[model samples]
Target: MERTLVLCKPDAVQRGLVGQILTRFEQKGLKLVGMKLRQFPKELLEQHYSDHKERPFFPSLVGFMGSGPVVAMALEGIDAIAVVRGLMGKTNAREAAPGTIRGDLGMSFSNNLVHGSDSAESAAKELALFFPGADELVDWTPCTLEWSYSVGEELKG
Candidate 1:
């Protein structure tokens, strides 16, 4: 099993898609280990997206993220990293395929509705950032061969 970080960005909350976004993952049979609705202070946003700081669009990205509340979650399952990203779809909404969270709800790149860890290392770092000092992120031992999975193996975080 792998651990991954899942973020339902501000747009998801603002658009009242929190339940829908979560249902996608839950229905996929992935375990929701830890979660919280956090108004990420500027300080934390800076850390979470520090890698993008040098990009020209970084400021706008940061501002948009801090503008509202987001749901931070810890997901556990096989290939969870890839699973979440596949469900989130492309970073650029225009390219996102239908049926994905981003494809279904997002309209622009900057406002893309969610962010999943892009790599395993990043997932660990993100989990720490959003759920520090917390364990039991997931109890995902399901005794079954078939389970609904939201992502494919290609998008491994």
Candidate 2:
């Protein structure tokens, strides 16, 4: 199965939307391989958002992210990265589709409720950052696997 990183950002945790966000992914058949709730260090946030270091909002972005506890998750499924992104909707809440997490719960661009890895490379990097130890991730098959994908589809994973 493909794996991806998903984060219920500080705003999501602060607003008590972490359960709802996690449910959306679970109901979509994504398996949770690793998860934790914690207040991240500024240094970790800096490394995680390093790509945005040159952007004007970099400082504030990191500040907000580290302001409270975040729910970090490592999920696995077929096309997990794309699936999580679809569920999260657009970065701009106003532009997100009605049924999406952001569309339903978010109200601002900076305070968007969640984050999902945008590509395979990102997934790998983010997962490693959030779940550094080899033992951190769990391996198992979901009972619903058969119902979620066909035989041929399961073979792809």
Candidate 3:
């Protein structure tokens, strides 16, 4: 199983959409290995969004993210990073597909409701930023794994 980080952004939390966002992943057969609700510190936000520091939306982006509690989740499944991204749809809510989380619940570009790591490298870095301790993540097999993947498939972490 591959693991990836997913965040229910402040807007999602504020709008009470965290449950629905999480359910979408769960129902997709992804296993939740770790999760927390937190009001992140500005320093952490800065580090997390460091790549966007040169972008125009950097300040407000960090501000909005730190404004309230956000749900950080570590999910595991086959190609979990890509899977989560597909569930989240495009970053700009207005352009997201109708069946996606953003398309269904969001309207603004800046206030898009969720975030998911886009690649293996990003997943590692973002997961570390959100879940630093080795003990923070749990390892377990979901009973539905067999049903989710083929009998001949190889499962890995």
Assess candidate 2 and give its lDDT. 0.93
Q: How much lDDT does each candidate structure score?
A: 0.84, 0.93, 0.93
Model 2, position 21, has a per-residue lDDT of 92
Measured against the true structure, the TM-scores of the candidates, in listed sequence, are: 0.87, 0.96, 0.96
Q: Write candidate 1's Cα lDDT for 1-157 as tens digits.
A: 7788888889888999989999998877677888999889988998999999899988888888899999998888778888888898999998999999889888888888888998999999999999887563656455542444433553346
Model 3 residue 52 distance off true place after TM-score fit, in angstroms: 0.7
User: Which lDDT tens digits does candidate 2 get at residues 16-112?
Assistant: 9989999999999899999999998999999999999999999999999999999999999988999999999999998999999999998899899
TM-score of 1: 0.87
Which parts of model 2 are misplaced by more than 4 Å? none
Steric clash pairs (candidate 2): none
Instruction: Indicate the residue-level lDDT of 96 in model 3.
Output: 95
Question: Which stretches in model 3 have alpha-carbon errors above 4 Å?
Answer: none
